[model samples]
Target: MESALSHRRFGSSDLMVSPLGLGTVKLGRDKGVKYPKDFTIPDDKAAADLIALARDLGINLIDTAPAYGRSEERLGKLLQGQRQDWVICSKVGEEFNNDSGDSHFDFSHRHTRQSIERSLDRLKTDYIDIVLIHSDGRDEHIIQHEGALEALQQCKQEGLIRAIGMSTKTVSGGLLAAELSDAVMVAYNPAHQEESPVLDYCARHGKAAILKKALGSGHLISEQDPAQAAMHFALSHPGVTSAIVGTINPEHLRENAEACQRALLQT
Candidate 1:
């Protein structure tokens, strides 16, 4: 029988997360997404069902952020009784202004600290498993000038977050994030392999590397199912700890999980 993929220890953190983390961007916002297709936002019940399915399929890492519409709130409610079953990861520095259908980022110390506090309250939890900086493509500046990293490190020290990381966008930024953070999220897909060096560095340094947009953000060019190929590519790299993919459809969830299983077998 096919089963959910195995887990990996996330960097130096105590968190042992699933190899395929469920990204919750579509759970909260569908208005200004980069998905090739558009679909209606799922109701709270639907969201709960998908989360339940994920858990049933052995997905333990749930990735969310303030920029992902009401995902944090929805997850707070949907996962009320089963909080311990999953390791929740959220982000700071970016906010989705639903009114304007636009986004704004604030990496100041005050905002960074306040956002973590707000996330705690919204998620109905006392602590977050992982907190990453939601980079706005300006990864280096955000990591340097902005106080986001300091705030996250402070929160980590205070026990507000178990681990600190950055969703970096560049090779240099990824390397820097790995040097400073316990985990670093990078974009890697079959079409692009430029970021492989970052992954290599992380592997050598014992830092966790999380892969984002592994399937080209669901904009795959090939007609065949890319789930297996994407998972293969993601896990093929020794540095990658996990791949985060956002999908609301149950079929996609099953397909992705099975593909991860097959990829693991191949490896």
Candidate 2:
């Protein structure tokens, strides 16, 4: 059967993405995460198998970041010869130091440009589908004072990125990002609804709202089929375009996709 989960336009951009995007943070990094438990990074063969499974389940959007240690590089190797089959979403402004297991932020113009170019090189792609500013809690200040967004806008103009936005950390930041960019990613789930105003604003303003931590970063899960309930709650919001669920488990990915499909149908 064809997928019940249909693709939606990402804001006003021409990129059509499935409602459930594959987040790849777990595919590369295992340290400095907020998950309920620890996990080993999947080997190349396992990662390739997981990617194939995601495609088979009708997921086209793959979310990654420089903060996701080795994610872009691994994807570059695994996604060889199949670049057209995925819409890659990457991030800048936050870099994960593998040796120290610490994260640092830089949203300056030079760092922003360097990050995009480095991502392009690591992904082995000429252009990325979407690029978001990885926030450091100072969402409002980052949007206003930093040059990352401006650099991303220039990248879009120059065709290095198809779309640019911020994975915002605040309601005000989300609203401002939506007004200035093609999309804004905010955290929204049953456990966290403080960002719903951002989604509502996106719904009314024709801006795309991409959700992160839709499962409460794996803390809100309880009982059987919690993914189904959590996904239903996230996707039921009218402003939501897609929710990025990071998992390296094949069974979990399939379950997440099915849950997303069921949620879309019910809504």
The lDDT for every candidate, in the order shown, is: 0.90, 0.92
Instruction: Candidate 2: list runs displaced more than 4 Å.
Output: 1-4
User: Model 2 — which ten-residue stretch has the worst lDDT?
Assistant: 1-10
Q: After superposing candidate 1, which stretches have Cα over 4 Å from the reference?
A: none
Tens digits of lDDT, candidate 1, 122-239: 9999999999999988989998898999989999999999999999888999889899889899999898788898899989999988888998888777677677888898888889
Error of 1 at 93 (Å): 0.6
Candidate 2 clash pair list: none
Q: Can you give the lDDT of residue 143 in candidate 1?
A: 88
Cα deviation in Å at residue 137, candidate 2? 1.1
> Native-vs-model 2 lDDT?
0.92
Q: What are the per-residue Cα lDDT tens digits for candidate 2 across 152-226? A: 999999999999999998889889899999999999988889989999999999898899999887788577767
Q: Tell me the lDDT of candidate 1.
A: 0.90
